[model samples]
Target: MGLHPIHTSKSYHDKDELGPEGNEFTSREEVFDYDFYKKLASDPKVLAIGECGLDYYRLEPETAAKQKESFIAQIELALELGKPLMLHIRNAYGEALEILRARPGARGDVHFFAGTWDEAREFLDLGFTLSFTGVITFARDYDEIIRNTPLDMILSETDCPYVAPAPFRGKRNEPSYVSEVVKKIAEIKNLDFEICRTALLQNALSFANIH
Candidate 1:
């Protein structure tokens, strides 16, 4: 299995101690350092350079700009190393898409995507895959986005230790929970569970560049 890094400024220590609010503990210094990623990229198990992207929800303008810079730097690294990217965009899809369209040799998924149909189409047009998480299973509003998105452009992730599906709502998520996402997509698109699972497995493999 290919392993992808979920880049964030929050320290794992802080996450372990404080939870999501612990994200507030993240320092600007920790967020902008490319040298850290250089060391991480050297690891053989690290397949991609991200879950890095902009988060306008909590960051100040300057901090958000720094996040964008770090994201671009990672994009460059992915280009140089010929690896795919794993993006985490929240409330900054426009900015993320702008940067992505401007850069060449950058490829990856926009994980846990919560954008509109037009926005989704834009990303698809730019050749990026859109990954859905367990949110789609419960969020009534996401039905249209789930239904409209083509199967080829669809990918599923648990975003584990995070967004868990129904019946397990408000619980810590794990990679095994990816099955829930698969089931939801199958229901939304009126597809067979096995077919959806196989197709998504293929999509995930292709996006990660695994032969």
Candidate 2:
């Protein structure tokens, strides 16, 4: 039941304030530097390369450029290291898809995915796994996305400290809440809970290269 923490700037700052074990990425800039990822990847505990990708929703145009640069760099690093990627995409799915298509053989999961069925299908076609957080349990739109995607391609996550599920909505999320996410996915996919759980567990293991 190990949790692989996704590193982000806010999480880094929070960890710094709390003085706890937390993964951190300074900015999109650091994501592209091979030396930085190489250093981080040296640690056996760091299993994946990112939560790295485009986020046109929140970023300014110039800043988004940096994000794309970082995203591409991290993708390259994942390929070089033979490690899976933890992608974070927002309103930039098309751009992300373009880059992914350009780089053949790059594999990863798009964490906390929010996109249309068509877009989801494109990702599936690209052979990338799609992960969803608790948002799908409460948001009608997200639930639709969950229902549309196939069970085998789906994975569950908490995106802790962010999108907590229904019962714990508005509370700080944690890895333990991944169960709620799993439950929601099971409901949407109309599959048995245990079966969904096993499949997601296998997907996680395979993505992280953990036998």
lDDT of 1 by residue, 75-130 (tens): 88888777778887878889989999999668888888988888888888888889
Question: How well does candidate 2 score on lDDT at residue 7?
Answer: 26
TM-score versus the correct structure, for each prediction: 0.84, 0.82
lDDT of 2 by residue, 1-211 (tens): 1112222222223454222333444432233456766777767787887777776644544566666666777888778877778887877889899999999888878888888888888898888889988777787787777777777788888877776788987677789999998998888778899999999999888888799
lDDT of 1: 0.76
Off by over 4 Å in 2: 1-31
Looking at model 2, residue 46 earns an lDDT score of 76
Please report, in order, the local distance difference test score of every candidate based on alpha carbons: 0.76, 0.74
Error of 2 at 54 (Å): 1.0
